[model samples]
Target: MSRAQEHPAPDPAELGLTSDCGSCFGLCCVALPFAASSDFAVDKEAGRPCRNLQDDFRCGIHADLRQRGFSGCTVFDCFGAGQKVSQVTFGGQDWRRAPGTAREMFEAFPVMRQLHELLWYLAEALALPDARPVHAGLRGALDATERLTRGTAQELAALDMPAHRGEVNALLLRTSELVRAEVPGKKKDRRGADLFGARLKGAALRGANLRGACLIAADLQGADLRSADLIGADLRDADLRGADLTGSIFLTQSQLNAAKGDAATRLPAALSRPAHW
Candidate 1:
């Protein structure tokens, strides 16, 4: 697995991991950098707003981002970082209006994003009945991360979130082990497999250790993925129309955004299917 895939994006609702662009200052459009790849049409430097960003902090072509060569935008989520930076850190100040604070705002956005993502995972870990043994530690981490997320701009920009994540990640690993113990099979060690575009319809993958597997564009229709270790697995464009993903670990909305699913797709409680699905 690539180093970038080691961390992924977040119970969105109760955990505040869901994106709320309406209340945001278009931080994602400005704070993130993207090159002209298959995912993006144009090269945009960090702290520079995308040309598609509207004056109202909305995307001018929100409905047709992919059609406009901005597929990356569709799959991106700020994990509530944009709104937090806009409302809490800057007190509703926007970069365009207050150019003085733009640099700090841009710098702190990604840091806040990481903290928020950790909070989302910690919240999920605490919710796992099988992971109750670590609930106290998870709750402590959640509270600490929450406090960090509410820090001042300088504090956030200087935050060492990776240190905090390492601590939280250890707890999550314990949580995963406890939950996977109930999968009722000898766990498969398929970690880092390059299963790209492989046909695996109706496969018995329950409790499989598929961590960091490159299942990109693979046909997984009607597959039984219950209790699979999907942490860092790339599900981009993978067909999961009727696949059962209940109890899958570390699956993210970004991964779901890049895939196709339907009513027959059973998901864990923390995840919801994309509307386009």
Candidate 2:
């Protein structure tokens, strides 16, 4: 699990952004597809239950997943979509019990997942102090997004998530600008830089724009990255110990999942410190 904490201690307001595996019906294990690669021991098709998935919707080898070559499962976080689908959308119905409804249920899982992910981002954006300028809009968007989550399965499957995301992204970008402006000095616009394996340890990157940057295996230990814009930044294997990410924009759990960090890595409240640190 990248040595990240086996379990995440999430913030109270960010509850919907965290996983509640116990309340879920193992939707991810059943609805997601995995290829036979370094992350998985065998290939599995979408909607097919994993061999290790227990009858009770738990991983049979949860504690031994890594040793059993199921590391890919460890990195995935459905952001509370699983339970919302299983308990709320499907009314606690398991796919096994209602085989006829399996296809729609499986398809709606991804759709609701995307919607819930947007809620996660929107909730975080609304809480940012610098985002006060657009709180009303963010709140409206949050309400709308939350409403979508409660829609019928067909409505979610037909949802134009890209359109909704576009609207929310515009507000998030504004929030980023406002937060970065708090720091004096011209923000470095390094969006989409190919910094693969770059050694940037302890670098002064506060308020830097690293949107979509390729930072694979980069050494960024102890770097000052407060208010940095990290939208879509590829942070796989990047060393982030002791780095400060306060007010950093658009940093997702998935990005953090792919990176290496320690206890000293200061993260924004929306994200948690990985246990591996």
My TM-score estimates for the predictions, one after another, are 0.89, 0.89
Name the top lDDT candidate: 1
What's the number of clashes in each of the models?
0, 5
Regions of model 1 farther than 4 Å from truth: 1-15
Instruction: Give each model's whole-structure lDDT.
Output: 0.84, 0.83
Clash pairs (backbone) in predicted model 1: none
Model 2 over residues 1-277: C-alpha lDDT tens digits?
7212442222434546567889888899999899998779999999899998888999999988768888777677788899889888999988888898799889999988887877877776765777778877877887788889889889988989899889988887887888788989877888899999999999999999898899989999999999899987998889998899887887887778778898888998767776545
Best prediction by TM-score: 1
Backbone clashes counted, model 2: 5
Worst 10 residues of 2 by lDDT: 2-11
